[model samples]
Target chain A: MDWNCTLTEERLSDYLEGSLLPGEAAAFSAHASGCVQCTQLVAQVKMLVSRMQQAPPVEEPRHLAGRILDATLGPREREHSGSGMFAWLPSIWQPRFAMGLVTVAASILIIFHASATAGGKTALNPVNMFRAANRQVHLAYAHGAKFVNGLRVVYEIQSRLTSQPETMSEPISEPARAPNAEPRPGQPAQPPASEQRQKSQSIPHSGRRHTHGASELAALSIISREDLTNGAIRSIL
Target chain B: MRRHTRRVYNLCYRFTGNAASSEDLSQEVFLRIYRTLPSYRPEQGAFPTWLTSVTRNLLVDHYRRTRRDRLTDSIEDAMPQLEEKHSPARTPDRLAQASELSAQLQRGLARLSPELREAVILRDLQGLDYAEVQKVLQVPEGTVKSRINRGRIELARVLEEMGLRPA
Candidate 1:
């Protein structure tokens, strides 16, 4: 078959793509090899086609998909301002918030339980609740004060007992008397000379110290009783 | 949906050479697709081919609708917007070169007739084979080949005139 510049130009893509018959391709190549304009045209078109094929697709706008979705699917529910009002509601379901709410509810229940049981019988009236809460608070404060006084008395008695051992190391010319022995009925009411000497030596302020020790022991007993009652109430609850 | 959107958007941008118009056209194409989805038959073609056809038809309509504006307005005014809009986060030297070449190619494509431009875009730029291009264009395979050939030649001459040698 005869080939010319027109045939070469018309079938240029087919020739470049190697889709033309072998004879036709040879003829097209021969014609293009001799023709300067055909060669340049072939080269130019070939390069342009290759460049275009290799060119990356243009980057679309970042929000193009979102816009298309919005247009096709209608506006999203989250985009509405009305729905945004309740957005914070989801946050309330978080573990941290749930735990906090549970703790507060438990504390309120405990307070109500304590107030209701302050008296022998349960009273749900506002005035009774107030009076019960007030009484409970005073009782708690008194129990705390008594416990502290008991600790101080125990520490003072321990120190005095420890000092007594050291004093007992000294030799005694008279026999030792019981510290709490009462005077015999027929005997004189005055204390023995040995007791007087020991009192004078051991206790510089005997009267005041003895009175304070007695009051502290009484407070300690009261605290022990309160603790037992509290334990029983807890076990019942 | 995202994949289809990008394909449609790239087609519109390459055809119109205007970012805003391309964006609007892309949305319009998908909107039409969404409405006519149920009517789409599987026997017609693959989903992408159908999508391309839909996009091409909308683009042709858009072209006719805005013929008067295109005649009166300069394409150069729309060319710089593409460059300004594309500020990639990390542009290596090669990417910058490709970006410049793409812009130049866009200018060249703008000078071609709509038929030739779309033929070249679908076949060469969009990487569709001749058969797919024929399906998208709804034309004979011979006509697709002819148009692609002429379009490439014309574009090459235009790019040469603009002092760009395709490397």
Candidate 2:
């Protein structure tokens, strides 16, 4: 085979696949052997093609054909036509089934997303979740958060009233008190020290010592606006 | 028909990296085929090419419809992840390396626009000849070839970036 000195780059794939003429094959071989760049390119092309070929063939999952038949045919039509006792059911009712399927799938997705984004730990541990969340609200409030943002602010204030202490600290060795447990007579409505201490210890409150500042009051007012009005109405009644 | 299933599956798998999505898409393609079987004209083209066209059209439609929903999933799963335990291989180290390369390639394929990726997959992964790709894509042979060439070069550049491809 008298060989050419060069092979066209565009036809390299065809030449490698043996799609070229015998004479063209002889020419490609000579060029590939003599030219380092062409040789490298051929090798790379072969590797690429081989990798594609090597991709393991994955079959359609078994029962898929049956499922497809069920989808496209009526139940009686499929049943009478196919002998298999387990022939596919009619898909005429599929729109309703599909709706239910979508609902179930959406619920599962919602649940999965919630658990995944929530760090997949101890979702059943309500005490811990509540405790952790209580601390977050406290921290956010400590930073003088401007808004709770949405219709959920009422719930936020309700929850904050339950878990967080009105005052951040407590004198040690006393039992914990609830955050909004009523204040003693003639005193400002700060929670008692022991109650504060117990609640603080129960939830790991890692923020700086609470600053009893004006922004904190403003945040509290914004959060408790509805609750405060109801409380005043109750007092008058 | 059974033999063609794997090819259809691989095409779907390439478009969608996950098994769950692949299964759904493949089933969707078959259902689509069943519905549109009446419109198929034998004289117009061969069956596999027709099937490929059907598959590609469904895949493109799926991409467009679900692109928005996919963004939310990306954001939700945005945290850096470590090795997944999906491989059945006994050699953990080799399996992990293989998976990383495969993942790199999948990512590269995904980075191409749908048109380029479809052309590349049909030509390279599916091993369809240029003319057959022209049939499936309903484009000129030259256009198909150009898209394929551009797609392969870009994919190779990506693979090289990951150090999966040699100089």
Candidate 3:
């Protein structure tokens, strides 16, 4: 067998383990039949495997298995046994389990604290304090008096649009004249200057109306965003 | 539970050369297995495969945690060929020779890089197939085969140095 490059390590390992696919196995067998290098590698691998198999396992101590089993399966058996016996126990009698739970909780808390300490992140470190303060400042900026003022402006605009519907009507047909001025004899009739000024002021009213769902939502969102914003959330809490 | 525990204990003892540490680690392994039972998915692989992986992981962790406590310390003195009553297939002289050879084999194994050691142990000692080892190692099958071959070559060399031929 001309094994030189044809006998790859993968094929050899697979062949040794009998895990190669049929085609690859057939190919390998064909190569091994004629390939000296491949046959020698196989022989060497076999010798190594035989020696390993012959090596006796280390002695296990008595009751080691029992301990392992106990560790593995003890909890389930305890759960089953305890549940049956402790089912009738009053909530007052639950203190033992509660105490055990508390101890575990305390240990976990200690572990967390110790880990933090080891990482140089003690709970009361100045960095944590600084971060807390910075967070608080951000929250205040997002949901403070300034935000409320903006919401109030929006609410006022909404009220004006809703209460003054006529503010959205079409413009007057004639040009403006001075306040309280009557139309000239030859001139087209026109609104008095005062009415024209009022109309001009109210023209903007229609634009402020919350006609679309998004706009309505915009009105509600002032409060909601404030609630979600860090400052607002902190305030609410 | 007792029978299962015994089987696992024996398995661990076979893997770890030290009896005491193996006993302790075996218990710890089982405890972890029990705690993680809720997350075990048999569909992921065979139960034994998963179990072997778990056991292997525990042993590695134990080795790491107690790096100072190696079998090499008492190996020369302790590598007597004998089997305890439980695993009674072993005869005294063959057992003693096998134990010494096992020690040499373990030393050879210990000398290997952990990755190579893992591949060799999975393939040879635990008798896992290449595909199963690939799954266990989360590596391509080609890489697994190379590691195994390289690992075996190194082991044979080490064995030769220790005056034990591969055969």
Candidate 4:
């Protein structure tokens, strides 16, 4: 009666349905004949299966078939249409088309604007270019000369003090001696106090932006100083 | 129009237990079958077996989504049609007993845990081989065997309460 090691439900179901292998079928039949518990279990299982078998088939809904069919077939129809190439064109070229249009419009506007500004000028580099550049260089050198002249005055004052130390302590008490201490020949005379202040205002501040003319003049002044140093060295040689 | 729909509809009805939901679910299953027909490999299994697998899958998904207690058929509002090609001929007494037994079997089947019920349904009711049942249930053959064993024992216990033996 104890059928602990009996055939399983899957095997028994197979047995009932006549789908079991010959060996399994033979073993099951022999076992069922001898074991009361397994026999009874098989009978109950058979009845359960019979009831299920008797139950009518379930009907699927009608529209679901249509819905699924439509889903699968819709793509096929689009693929078969004559405008397939046309449909795909937008997808392929949309981004490139947008970029090309923007580039062409920008290029057209640049060319038109450049021509409008050019007006009737023969070329960008006329004789005027060289003249304007040379003028700027000249102006820078003139300003540099003024600076050197002021430094000469300061140096003269220092040398005069060393040559005559009495002038340093007697500037206020011996103001009469100042008139005789005029600048020597070929040395520029010091400007009046108000005139000197005006000249000082003309000097460029280091941090301020300079005009193109000022920059060219400053470059010329540097070249002139280098030339002077080379002349001095050659004379010594 | 009505008869054909009704027959297939009845199959869905019994399988799902709720006539209304079965109608909807069955429609969905057939639609799936219709769409997936091109992909079905005959070498894998028969069409009916494949259809049943699809139906079972759909029912399982619905059961999980609803989280309804499947072990109790307390909401049984309708019975599946009893007449079928496989229904064995019987005397009135046996027929009454069979009907009662059939209802009890349904209740017992409803009571089974989904795992055991799936194994039993796939192996017994669907008539799938062990290997085929393994594929359908997506479990090892041994696991399929154990679930079927447990499910059968539970069903036998249910039957014993009604004074029925294997007969």
Candidate 5:
């Protein structure tokens, strides 16, 4: 029988353990009997394995099981920090650096929060929003006062026009011009400016003509774009 | 759990050679086992084999994490050669010799690569069968056997260096 060095080394453990097939075992035994090198190799490995097998195991702690159970059930109490974030590190790890880092991080957050609350008002007031509202209020009030005065004059003009509608044909237009002494020889129908003003200011004689003028003026006075510009939203509120 | 606690502890001790690390690793192993209880399928493999795999993985993680702190040593110069001293075959003498041998073996075990060391520890030290080792290692039977043989050879070389040559 021929001994294959590689094959013998590979199957030596199986052979020693009696796990090899009957025929293979017999053949290996025959080869090992003739091959001193393989035989010595087997003996040396066997002795090494025996010494290793006899190697004494270190004793386990009595409290390990209790500690494990307590850890799993309750909050994990530190036991040498076996699986902790710093567990991988040696005892030489500097706690001071870690503490400093945490302190810096916490301080940064606190300072950021303080600054945000304190500075947010001024920081976000990109356009002086409070001043904008104040300016808008002042303008609206000024425009509203002017608008009210203009409305009173409009009402007076409209009331006069409605009362004197029969005289409104070319008569209302004559008061805006200056009084003149010149009179046309063929066109004596137009009144002088002062007389035109006096006549227009008085009420007209026709009832149907006055009613028409009053209805038209009332319709025109209901709303105007100037009302919106003068903060008419205040009325809605 | 009690039956295997010693084994897990000793394996950790052998790997780390530290009492504190063994205790911590033992607690962590049981904790991990409890955490992973739902994932264990009995039909796939035996419980011990599964437990050993978990333990080996944790030790590997420990080794890598602490590699920066671990001291490197020359395997040849690690243990000095000495003249073999013959003592009377007394119980005390045998116990002392066993204790001394135990220390030398541990140092030797530490010097081996993690894979070979694990294979040797699982097969020879822990007394697990090849099949169980294969399951724990997740390697082919051939690989397990080769690793064991290689590990034994290296362990024998280390022991020889420590002046414990077999007649």
Candidate 6:
């Protein structure tokens, strides 16, 4: 192969890229080793190609992407603003803001409904509103107190009923004791057998009466022992 | 979008050697792409190659359109503007050397003819392979290689003339 300066110049990139035929590459290298202009050209071009390949790309303008988008997509909706005193009015359309507005409106509606019902007539007057609010507060307090007293009475009945079994479980003295017994001065005299039987039967009735009185005070109704037990079991479950 | 924009912008900046014009040309290229997006067939080429082709066509049209203006306005006047835009003081410390070399290379690229400049940029700076460059240039592979070869030599000479020895 007749390798020359022209061949070297034409095949310069191929030689640099190592894509030339082995024979051609050998010939090209042989020619360039002896030729001063070819050697210098090869060195310089090789260095230039390497540096260019390694060169960092020029930084584009930061806003070029935004500008292109605006140009392509027609200048995005400008974030919904108005040139008026109520500039923030458009912000109310946001989902979060709208949700908050709905909650506030519902709360106001509830307040008005309660006031109208409590006052016996709907009026926007401040005095009427205040009076209705006061009445509502007093009614709520009364209901709360009533509820607390009912719970207290139910618990008290449950405790007394539970304690009655323990009292009855204690050992009862023998009923066959002598009819006539000597009385000691310091000790209280035992009641007669018939009296003792009457007293024992009267004890549970007295407890029932006490429970009835408490239930009347708390709930304005009578609650039997069985009902109180059922209520307590239901509360526990 | 960001990747495509950077590619287009880099091509424009390399070809035109002006940041403002590159930005405008990049937007224009994307706008053209947007309008003609339907016409783009994936079977024809990869999207990046198509994008590069669109950018190259626009650059060629831009070069032709601004030939008269470029002739009237001194290139020396434009060089300072580019330098001021990419001043070393403004660039971060790590990028200062690369930036300087890039600026110097830009000046050298400006001296080459449009065909040679585009060839060198696509092959070397843009890192397009010969086949891809051929596709983007819409030329035969032989012409792409020849042009890249000549462009590299011419650029080296130009850079040497400018006292910049590539490391």
DockQ scores of all models, one per candidate: 0.45, 0.16, 0.26, 0.16, 0.32, 0.57
| Over 4 Å off, model 2 | A1-42, A74-237, B70-107, B165-167
Where model 1 places Cα greater than 4 Å from the true spot, the runs are A78-237, B74-98
Q: Considering lDDT, which of the candidate structures 3 and 5 is the better prediction for this target?
A: 5
Candidate 1: pairs in clash = none
Q: Candidate 6: which stretches are off by over 4 Å?
A: A77-94, A97-237, B75-98
Classified by CAPRI criteria, candidate 3 counts as acceptable
TM-scores vs. true structure, each candidate: 0.61, 0.46, 0.45, 0.39, 0.49, 0.64
lDDT of every predicted structure (CA atoms): 0.78, 0.64, 0.62, 0.58, 0.69, 0.81
Q: Top DockQ: which candidate number?
A: 6
* Pairs of residues at least 3 apart in sequence or in different chains that clash in candidate 2: A176-A195, A177-A195
Residue-level lDDT of model 1, residues B1-167, one tens digit each, is 77778789889988987767888999998899899999999898899999999999999999999998766766444554454456343234424544877878887888899999999999888888998999999899999999998988889888887778886
What stretches of model 3 exceed 4 Å from their correct place?
A: A1-11, A15-42, A53-59, A72-237, B1-7, B10-15, B68-101
Candidate 6 per-residue lDDT over residues B1-167, each given as its tens digit:
98899899999988887767888899999999999999999999999999999999999999999888878877554464455456443345424534777877888898899999999999898889998999999889999988999999998898887788887
lDDT of 2 by residue, B3-106 (tens): 66667777886776555566677778888888889999999988998988888888888889988876766742232122124423213553444445455556
* lDDT string, candidate 3, B108-141, tens digits: 6656677777777777776678888887777897
Candidate 4: segments with Cα more than 4 A from true spot: A1-39, A46-237, B1-15, B35-45, B68-102, B162-167
The deviation in Å at residue A9 for candidate 4 is 7.8
- For B40-73, candidate 5 gives per-residue lDDT tens digits of 9999898888889999899999989877655553
Give the CA lDDT, 0 to 100, for residue A114 in model 3.
48
Model 4 C-alpha RMSD vs. true structure (Å) is 22.7
Q: Count the clashes in each prediction.
A: 0, 2, 5, 16, 2, 0
Q: Better model by TM-score, 4 or 5?
A: 5
Candidate 5 per-residue lDDT over residues A1-237, each given as its tens digit:
455877787788778778888888988888887889888777877777676677776555666766767867765644455555877554434697678878999997775554445456672463554555566689989888877876666565555645554454335333333233255677675677787557545645443454565556445543343344244444433
Clashing pairs in 6: none
TM-score, first chain, each model: 0.40, 0.26, 0.23, 0.23, 0.28, 0.43
The worst-scoring run of ten residues by lDDT in candidate 1 chain A lies at A169-178
Please, what are the lDDT tens digits per residue for candidate 2 over residues A1-237? 544433446556567567789887877888788888667666765665567556554445565555555665734344334446634445534699879878999997875555445545665366655666676689878545433332245455556654544443343112223333567788668767787667566665322233333346546655676566465445434
Better of 4 and 5 by lDDT: 5
- Model 5 interface DockQ: 0.32
